[model samples]
Target: MRVTLKLATSLDGRIATGSGESKWITGEAARVEGHRLRAGHDAVMVGVETVLADDPELTVRLPRSDEIRQPLRVVLDSRLRTPATARLANPGTMILTAAEPRPVGTAEVERVEAPDGRPAPAPALEALARRGCASVLIEGGGQVAASFLGAGLVDRLEWFRAPILLGGDGRPCVAALALAKLADAPKFRRVSAEPVGDDLWERYDAIR
Candidate 1:
């Protein structure tokens, strides 16, 4: 399966304010474009932290189209921290965790053991493929995006940059990487860069 990391950040590379307020990082046009992008993927994924912060529905909230395709919502909560009342606990949602499968609202809880602290993207991507997911859109809050990127699992990156700046005190767009050398960093080749309303949409091909 192909994994695409999508992110919206300020000019200073911050996804949110210092106080965790991330309601609108980009413009309305960018948000609608994001929803349209989600509609093309087989599944949409995020981390437990994102869930706790946003409680996003994870649904493709766009205008009705002739070919409507709603992607499955996938959550990575290795410890099963995702609450039953979470907004993503709908019928089309799937939770991956190390704990035993427990009943959550219409969603399926699958046991995904990660011996290490980080959940292995290989197995998770394999599982997604087994369920007929050819493509996955990862909309995250730093850690999750870093996990996939660090694991060399991301195939593409869609970054939306707004003109506003959040300064150094804001939350970064991505988490820290444990790279020993500068050459060890994940690299990407820019595929396209276009202006999306007041925001800039950049697409990159992940260099494996």
Candidate 2:
């Protein structure tokens, strides 16, 4: 599947404050553009920590249009910790977990092999591919972003950066890759950069 990692953060590449407040980091235009990006993808994904923290709907909220189809929502919940009452626990959402098969509200649950307790990116993508997902937009909370990028699965990046700064204590957009050398770092070639209201939207494609 074509994996696109999307990040909306502050100028310092921080997704949230030191205390975890992340609402309205970017302007309305950037968020609208984000929804458009989601509309273009076949599925949208996030790690379980994001669900537990933000409880986002993960659905496209564009203006009413018959052409708009909500993408399938996918969650990487290895331990099956996502509560059934979460906003995403409904039809059209799928939870890929490594835990024993069981019901999670009305959402579909699929068990995948994860030896490390966390579902690996490649196998998770395979599961989505089996479900006929041609493209996936990974809209994150750090660890998920790192996992995909570290696995060399991200095909494109759609990053939105606001003008404000959140400092070193703030939460980063991507968790550490634990690279031992600078040459081992995953590289991306800049595709485009443009302003979206008070935020800057940057696009890139994986160097590979």
TM agreement with the true structure for every prediction? 0.96, 0.98
C-alpha lDDT (0 to 100) for residue 166 of candidate 2: 96
lDDT of each: 0.88, 0.94
Worst lDDT run of 10 residues, candidate 2, spans: 61-70
TM-score of 1: 0.96
What is candidate 2's lDDT per residue for 92-139, written digit by digit as tens?
999999999789889999998787798889999999999999999999
lDDT of 1 by residue, 154-199 (tens): 9999999999999998998789878899998999999999999999
Q: By lDDT, who's the top model here?
A: 2
- Error in Å for residue 116 of model 2: 1.6
Which residues of candidate 2, in runs, are more than 4 Å off? none
